[model samples]
Target: MAEQPTRAWYATLRHLWLDERDARRAVPPALAERLRERVAASERRHSGQLRICVEGGLPPSYLWRHLRWRVPMPKLVHQRALMLFSRLHVWDTEHNNGVLIYLLLAERRIELVADRAVARRVDAQAWSALVRDLGEALHHGRFEQGLLQAVDGVTELLAPHFRPADDGPRPNELPDEPVLR
Candidate 1:
């Protein structure tokens, strides 16, 4: 793991102020539907599974862990993303090519977690670059554009290894909707 930056002193209060409503506002129903369509379309070209999760804030449990364990904010956020990656079953795909694009609204942090199959093929710097690019868009409140580009980016990365021989519909191992929380 990369060395985590120190936690901001005001991080707790910031998280407390955000909630599911913020997530919903950031990704409204129409935008969520668009993202779902993008993911579905991307899946049709490859065997990989993609999941997008936008969270307004860290859960209380993670907040408590941060306080007690003195975990850096970045590490804590990454942990939350990884936990969701597992809970959402992004790692259970037939090709082991699942990818999770996660966003924390309160912190404006983005974490991309790829299953081992995809991870081994892609470089860590590539993942970091994707997250950084998405972070720039999110910082500018270009949520829809950012997510669409992210889906396209992830699809490009996975297509080389997972593309199907034919254009027939691929098995969808996960829901396409962006999880708002």
Candidate 2:
């Protein structure tokens, strides 16, 4: 009898996340090795899948509501609204050249948005280097490490600012204002 074709990477990841015991068992060591190899090889590629989503949105609110027959609490409802907005506006910069890979597991879709300028600047060699590094990391079961490296690269390029704290001010320490004539 012939062996079954291997499942896709995303499918494997989803299965792992969902705690599918059978799927987990079916995942061969070779498949895991291949995934690691692919991650390493990704460094050569000029593109990357930068997946961003609201963490609490996992399983999705609509599905949860349908199952529960009522809306989720406000805290759970909007846990990461700002983070989602920032992903769309702040992290997405025109100067950066690359493809944006958006994977929405809830909707079961992937989107590829490309930035031409960054692509042009990042030669095949540099891209390959990144892929290789990523592959090695993934092979070692270090997905978060690879992601952090990618994010760090983008953050360094963007250099976004944060508001500095007012060293002299305390809420109740303010002086009274004089009345105007």
Best by lDDT: 1
TM-score of 2: 0.32
State the TM-score for model 1: 0.92
The TM-scores of all predictions, comma-separated, are 0.92, 0.32
lDDT of 1: 0.88
> Per-residue CA lDDT of candidate 1, range 1-181, in tens?
2233234436777898999999999899999999999999999888899999999999888887777777778899999999999999998888889999999988889999999999899888888888888888878878888999999999989888887647566567899999999
lDDT of 1 at 177: 98
Poorest lDDT segment (10 consecutive residues) of candidate 1: 1-10
Candidate 2 global lDDT: 0.35
Cα lDDT tens digits for candidate 2, 1-181: 1222122233334423642232223233454344344433332232232232212123434335433443433333233333342445423533333333232322233222334554554455544555456446546756446544544443332222211124642221111111010
What is the C-alpha RMSD, rounded to one decimal, of candidate 1? 3.8
The parts of candidate 2 lying over 4 Å away from their true place are 5-114, 153-181
